[model samples]
Target: MARQDTPTNEMSLRWTVCGDRDVTVRGAEPGDVSALRRFIDGLSRESRYFRFLSGGQVGDAVVSRVLGRHDGRDIALVVTDGEEVVANAVYVVNDADEAEFAVVVADAWQGRGLGRRLIQHLQQLARAAGLRGMRGDVLSENRRMLAIVRELGFSTRRAPGDAYVQEVSLRLAAVTREAWLAHDWFQG
Candidate 1:
């Protein structure tokens, strides 16, 4: 099978959160380095740790390196609100034809369903790129995240050698885009 190239065209998903707030999630660009930095720096200490899986200052050097490769490849997506990034998600494809994913939503934006939207968008992008599956490692304490992935058809297991971490994976081939999007969290 011929390997598929990463998606190149730009697609924007606009959604209204909290009934009155509007936001947009789209492909992360190289110019987003500074904005990305601000977004990371704005994350509460706990949020940063949850996203990075460790506790330490997320420095410019690290942000720059991350954006360096996020230039329209490897599936990087960000949700922006009026000028700042409120959420970020990415899924890097591996040799096994699966993409390892992660998502971080701003503390203030938590509980508004931003993380789920970001992951769903990332899955769409990855599936379009021919990835067979998507997976993420979540800290055991993050019950909300675990529940979200489970509701999206991802199966979870204890990460080998790490009891505190849960490895969750979804078989992208089994989910049709229409069906996936139809599982909208906005529905009451």
Candidate 2:
């Protein structure tokens, strides 16, 4: 993938995925509530179910939770295409050395490796926050998300008491070094 930078400071992260499409990712801010709503609205019911593990309509409370992050113990990231949010990733850090994470990509943006990029960005952010790992529970039927997590090297186990869900986790140090090595080799 190749990247070309632009002057969007609020969304400083830029990358190329799926060959040549450019995506700019950045931390979510107060101003993104409308964008977040629009992104959620664009998702299909199945897509929302896979991400939130629910079949009902997405509530404003979910948006508020995504907006809430006063203690610095949680991180929310959004990828944009200069107009609206196309993907969202978040991790809620616990007292332990790990965090619980979740991600949702717009229906129009699926299958382009955006999910993988979001997970990688989340891993980097979690590692910087002194987190040991990041984890999330995925519905068993959500094969696409499960495959993405597995491809990124996360380990999966059955979510307790829920035969339909699988819990996935990844150790930060493990992937951190691998990412560094890849970058180092590329630069050599």
Candidate 3:
């Protein structure tokens, strides 16, 4: 298979973090499955419950889908501390006009800006892939994720569902090279 060419930035890049630990965020590779599993397994029971809406583990088929390549426009990125996968963000191209997004961060790394960084990178990837907008559903009680989406300027609306089940749809602003460059969280 032909490799996708990542875009080159013409200017210097900067990232802001609230923690001391060093983190690296990059495109996910097939070989990183075990690391990804380890990180996912480390999330708190509540976090896992919130993310998957169930107690069951993330299955192999889902992992394969997350790690697979697409003939259309899509990208998946993983954040790591050396050999461990601590977070992942994915952008699934829906059409010429929009894309779908999802992100997961380990419990141990929560509240440290890794999710924000991952989303920022995902946004850059979306723009580079020529997508116009992005959207996703987040549980309403997931405040950390809500704050991240709000900080990134996504317009959110209550999702239609069983009234008792809480969730919201986050729709990001039209993705453009200039807007991505202007984002405070963008590192490259």
Candidate 4:
């Protein structure tokens, strides 16, 4: 199979965290399994709980699934400091013109605005891929994530049949357009 070009800054994404920290946000490559594993391994139990709904160490099977290409429908991204993965995000397109996503940032990097940047990148990627919107299910207790999504203007509600989870979604055109406007405003 031929390789597709990974998403890069040419796509209008150049994320910087904490004002001066240069963070490279890009699509995950097939060869990044090891780095992905290391990143997951570094997550604290509580962080893993919020991310995977599982505590303690992340399983090998879960790692494998995360690293899979999934027939090109999965768009996985990572934010790295030099060569270390500090955060990760992914969205898998469903047949209903929407994609579901999950994002996790390392504990140390939690308050540095990386998650927002990753979501913005995903919104752009989803629009370019012709997706209508992106969605995700966050634990009801994951207030930080819920608040972030709310701040990003996602429409959210309790998931059907699951009071313990909340569903979040944003229209691709709406979000990516908002991001573009913010980018241009910053440039001006």
Candidate 5:
């Protein structure tokens, strides 16, 4: 597969998926802030809570940090259906080699592999940015994300928080350029 550098125009991406169902992944831009907000707003309450660890509310400062960080230290990708944003994934490098990741898919678009695609895309970005691995803290009740993590071969361990409350941390194996390129999920 060919990897193009991040696109300068958020809307100038060439759709790689077929059947007129456009799917292009790229870095977030200034113009995409509102669309990203709208997409986040469209997420189901359950999904929001699962991703953000809170009931459907995220502060504007957090949203802006995710959307406006064009530098490689932070990365965000938006998957659009025509003009509507349907899925999003973001990652921020925490240390020299580790990054934390989160993903959200609109309620209507769940179970079509959009979440998988977004994770794959984010993994590519993470590897490109020299991150050794990606980590995520997923709620125990979120089975969809758990399945995705397993499918991607992440080694999971229960994060030490309130043991009485349920949640687990998943750490994906080190992703190299070769490993990412060789991943079966990316092979057409």
Candidate 6:
């Protein structure tokens, strides 16, 4: 996949998950820093460590980085339930043509499909940006996330230099279920 001038600025839209429930899913806006911080700070300690791999709060610079202030090639998404930020997901395209990703869902939002849906959305955005693949690093104990990505067609291996982390990756160009499922609208 070669880089093209594809616009990945997904418009803010209210998404109806099933037939009755509605959720606002949109690109991470500059004004969302406080909400994003609240979402992260509201997560359980275990979840925060799993998402950031650190006990310290993520600095404002990194938050702005993911919010795409430094690079438009990167993408971040926000999921809100009414006025509360419920989830955040992002992908940074590295020089290797692989989009490395990170996703976190609020404590109460766990067990729901928000994480999976956000990952699928990230995959679509990465594909449109001509990224060859998407990958993420998860703790060995994060069985839930491992299961989600595996079910979505990602394969995992032990991360180099780290015994407790698993590196999961999915090739976007491959003919796979997620590809069609995520972009079924134009898959002719």
Writing each residue's lDDT as its tens digit, candidate 2 over 93-178 gives: 87677978898989999888788777877887788888888888999999998998999999999988999999999888655676
Per-candidate clash tally: 0, 0, 0, 0, 0, 0
Off by over 4 Å in 3: 1-19, 70-72, 164-188
Clashing pairs in 4: none
- Residue 175 error for model 6, in Å? 6.0
Note each model's CA RMSD in angstroms.
8.7, 5.3, 8.3, 7.8, 6.7, 7.5
Give the runs in model 6 whose Cα sits over 4 Å from its true position.
1-10, 17-20, 174-188
| Model 5: per-residue Cα lDDT over 21-133, one tens digit each | 55666667778878877877777788788777777677777767767365657877777777788777888777656667888888887877778767776776677666777
Relative to the unseen true structure, what is the Cα RMSD of model 4? 7.8
For model 4, residues 10-110, the per-residue Cα lDDT tens digits are 42234556656766777677778899899999999888999999978888788777754657667877778888999988888887888788999999999
Q: Considering every candidate listed, which one attains the maximal TM-score?
A: 2
Q: Give the TM-score comparing model 2 with the true structure, all chains together.
A: 0.84
- Model 6: lowest-lDDT 10 consecutive positions: 1-10
Tell how far residue 99 is off in model 4, in angstroms.
1.3
The TM-scores of all predictions, comma-separated, are 0.82, 0.84, 0.75, 0.82, 0.75, 0.81
Off by over 4 Å in 1: 1-9, 68-73, 174-188
What is the lDDT for 70 in model 1?
Answer: 53
Best candidate, lDDT-wise? 2
lDDT tens digits by residue: candidate 3, 13-70: 2233453455555667788788877776787877776666655687876776676475
TM-score between model 1 and native: 0.82
**Model 2: ten consecutive residues of lowest lDDT:** 2-11
